[model samples]
Target chain A: MQSKISISNLDFYYGKTQALFDISMEIPERQVVAFIGPSGCGKSTFLRTLNRMNDTIPIARAEGVVKIDGENIYAPGTDVVALRRKVGMVFQKSNPFPKSIFENVAYGIRINGLHKNKADLQERVEKALRDAALLNEVKDRLNSSAFGLSGGQQQRLCIARALAVQPEVILMDEPASALDPIATQKIEELVVELKKQYSIVIVTHNMQQASRVSDKTAFFMLGKLIEFNPTQKMFTNPDERLTEDYITGRFG
Target chain B: MENRLLDQQLDLLRDKILLLGGTTEAALHRAMQSLTERDSELAKKVMDEDRIIDQMELEIDRLSVEILALQKPAAHDLRFVISVAKITPILERIADHAGSIAEAAIKINQEPQLKNYIDMPLMAEIAAEMLRTALDAFTSEDAAVSREVILRDQKIDECYHRVFDELIRIMINNPQAATCAAHLMFVAKHLERIGDYVKDICELNVYLREAAFIKHSPNQ
Candidate 1:
């Protein structure tokens, strides 16, 4: 239960409006933590703050501390690119590079110059695909366009791209919301499998998905972190009444 | 975010479970009355009414499975459905015990009248009261009342031990009275078993209210 990331007294703002209240929690290493709440509840926003993904917005401001592996990621002069490489992200929609499946996964390694040679790059791409649970499905079609794969396969390809960088942590924002049930199952299984090697933080609207894949769940509401508890306890007998109502579909 | 559809289905499930509880309670009462009054016809009626209890159990099972499969209830709803599903079979089994008591009553009535049925009637009353209180606690989701009902089972157990010793003495004093004494002993045993079943129901009620299993852990 060693913590990989720690956030203390963190507050986020967009322009003049505050988007997150003082939030603090420990994200344990090699465990999947799920963020769940209603829309506009700042779950996704808080997720982006982990890797400073919110820095892309000119009006965004973050206060307090977000430390990864004992190093404060929000400190001045922190290497943003290196931090992102350590914490890769997958979006809701599968945004493949419009390149071949192999190249799409190879893009991150190539940019980071992680491979020793062409053969090493090839090995890295295949390994990423294998780790993503997509190698068997796409092995014969690695040279084909990324768009040619099914929606679920394309989502896994995006995950493979994220994996190619060998991130210590993976942040997913509703990674399976657009896929069918079968596809969603694959992504859910992949999330469970990936937790053995990577600390994963996922923001999902689906409560069952959070219950299924996460070791711990953080419930957010109105830009405030209401409760963080073991996923089994959260779903069965949550301590906070707000957490109970939200999970039980009684929130207004 | 009020889920009216889920709420309505849950209401139906609650109504069905309560109906089954009421029916089982009635069966236990009628069976005990048949035994005390030496009414063979009433005993037969209790036996015949058992099929209705069986049918109700099946219906409740069907509804519980439907809610689990289609609604996919979580949190309190999930626990409530699971509690009802578990309690249905326990209630049905209690009714079966009552039916067995009614059978024993008919057999004992065929011979000469047994001694005044004092402790047996008291044991039956205590069992009926425990069941009624357990059902009320279930309806109100009252964990305190469930805990209280569980403690009441001890009273039934005490009465059972008393009846067992008294019946054994009677059988020893008059060897010819062994047949009727043996049947009365079975009636006492049925009431004791009913007490245990009521305890199980109370445990489920505690779980439904508090989300804790107090079955094996008495301190809980």
Candidate 2:
């Protein structure tokens, strides 16, 4: 399988306090790769570096090569906006704007000028909603406020908004952590379905969710990548003692 | 972090699986001892105790399912639970084979005695030893011992083939001993199957230790 993103000897820092060690991994194209560890283990920090999402933080800085399709994204003169457009992100909290459902889905398309006309924007919004598995739930109420929907629906809206720009990769940081089990199941199923077209990188504290949604799993600890293997192999028999200890609830 | 409750539950499950293995192993010993010692009453006792083994299997399966559903265990814990769930049925089948051997013993004791047991008793010894070692490997989580038990299964198979040829020779030479020899052959077959079940248990022990199955693998 072709790699969608590759990180080699990557390190991240926030004002001299290192958040990540020499992390190196290759996320295969159109496969779900999960980053799993405890809070502050650098799973999320490593994930944000993929699209340069850490650039906004005042003290955040990164070194080493983060390549997408053999092009170093951290090289000089690289457009951060275009990188983010190609590698969209969803967050732990479902932060849907106080706009209508259609507008929420259409927000990215309009900002990027991705559509040629109003009809084109409408089609793209519907397709994104369908891809997010939320079209039928709110098709009749596209004009309704995004907040009117439940937390899970709002999260899917955020996912649909990410999908609107046709990103080649989607990075989800605990996308369903705030939702209930059934809602979480829907999002997990949607993620599995979306992998057919887009590569997915998920950071999750829920080990079961990572096992359920990801084809490949990376375990992290103390700012280091401890183990990377197929999800089944990682869950069944992780190589490192720390990875086994953490996954078995023995220690973290 | 410690999930004390899950850890305790898993420990309890391990103990229960050991108990099941012990019960089945004892039943096989009693069954074979009855056959070899010409004790029909002891054979009847082995037949009666099969129900308890069945019940133990069901209880183990129930606990395994509960742990899987409630704890969502991963890594070694997951492998252990799944291995127990699989090993339970294999042990139950071994107990059933023991019961069959007991029945054959009862039937053979009613008939006129054939030539004294030779390879059949040896086969029973090997099968019982395999079960004991396989259970030991399970408790110790020793793949090395498991690999030994897997290789030991072939010894029992060789003993079974010898018992078959000797029984056929006895039947052909002495026409009156044909029914007795047939019953002995069935007993040998039951013991052979018990060996197979023990090998299955050994394979599960290997899986629990290594998280890789060696069954039907040419490389192993």
Candidate 3:
């Protein structure tokens, strides 16, 4: 039960406004940890801090240590590009490249130089697609545009793209929010399967989805980590009153 | 605030369960009275009224299922619906015990009286009061009262044991009193079982209020 990622007294700010306060947690290796909270609760912001994705925002400021495998990711001279490669992200909206389906998944492989020959790259793409559970649906349509797939398929394609880089951890920010119920079920099932090889942190507004897919759940409120426990315990009987109230639909 | 309709439906479920509790309690009380007074007419009436209790249980079960299927209630709501579903069968079974007591009373009334019924009536009173208090605890969401009701079950058990020993002694001393004493023993047994069902309801009450199971007996 090794910790894949650990955050200690992590704080984040957007310009002068503090967005997260003293947030600390450890995500266990090969387990799906869900971050659940209302909108503007800093769950997504904290997720971005894991891979230093916040660096893209000019005014975003992050403080404290985020360690993946005991290495301080926030330390000076740490390669953010390589860090992002180790910790990949899927977004709320599925943003697939407008290229062919095969190319969309192959883009990460080619850029990372993860494979040797043409056949090697093709094998990597297929493996990533199969890991994402989208290979059979798009196998015959590999040459078709990524946009031609359904919203759910496109999301899976983005997941395959993330998988191609061989990330040890996958961060999903409301990965199934845009899809319908059946599609969402597919993504949830995929998350369960993916946990075998990769540590996963998912930011989800849907409580049922978190209960369905996550091993551990963290309840955040107003930029603060409120309660974190096993998903079953947190959902059935949370320690904090606020967490119980929120999960029970008494308040947000 | 999230589900106003679900809230309303839960309130309705509470009312319905309370009503069922009231009816079953009355049946127990009347059955006990019939036994002690040798009122065959009242005993027959109590036996007949069991059908109403059965129908009420089915209705409560249907309502619980509707809430489960339509609302997908979670947390306390989920516990409440589940408690209702569980408690209805318990109430139905309690009513069945009352009916059995009434049947024993009718048979006992046909024969010559063995002894004056004192402990059996006391046990029935204690069990009936436990049922009433457990239902009250359910409506008030009062775990304290549920704990008290669970604790009170021992009183009924003691009363049953006493009645059982007395009947056994009476049958041993006078062989002619065997049939009547046996019927009295069954009446005491039925009352004891009613007390156990009331304990079940109290356990469910604790589950509803605290979301925790209280496994220890009243004395324990």
> How many angstroms is residue A62 displaced in model 2 relative to the true structure, after the best TM-score fit?
0.7
Give, for candidate 3 chain B, the lowest lDDT window spanning 10 residues.
Answer: B211-220
Give candidate 2 misplaced runs (Cα > 4 Å): none
Worst 10 residues of 1 chain B by lDDT: B109-118
The segments of candidate 3 whose C-alpha lies over 4 angstroms from its true place after superposition are: B216-220
> Order of all candidates by lDDT, from best down to worst?
1, 2, 3
Report, in order, each candidate's fnat: 0.73, 0.91, 0.33
What is the per-residue lDDT of model 3 for residues A1-252, given as tens digits with 9 covering 90 to 100?
Answer: 899999999999999999999999999999999999989899999999999999999999998889999999999999998999999999999999979999999998888889999999999999999999999999999999999999999999999999999999999999999999999999999999999999999999999899999999999989999999999788766778888778877773
Better of 1 and 2 by DockQ: 2
Clash pairs for candidate 2? none
Clashing pairs in 3: none
lDDT of each: 0.94, 0.93, 0.91
The alpha-carbon deviation from the true structure for residue B133 of candidate 2, after best TM-score superposition, in angstroms, is 1.1
Which model scores highest in DockQ?
2
lDDT of 1 by residue, A40-84 (tens): 999999999999999999999999899999999999999999999
* TM-score of the first chain in candidate 3 relative to the native first chain: 0.99
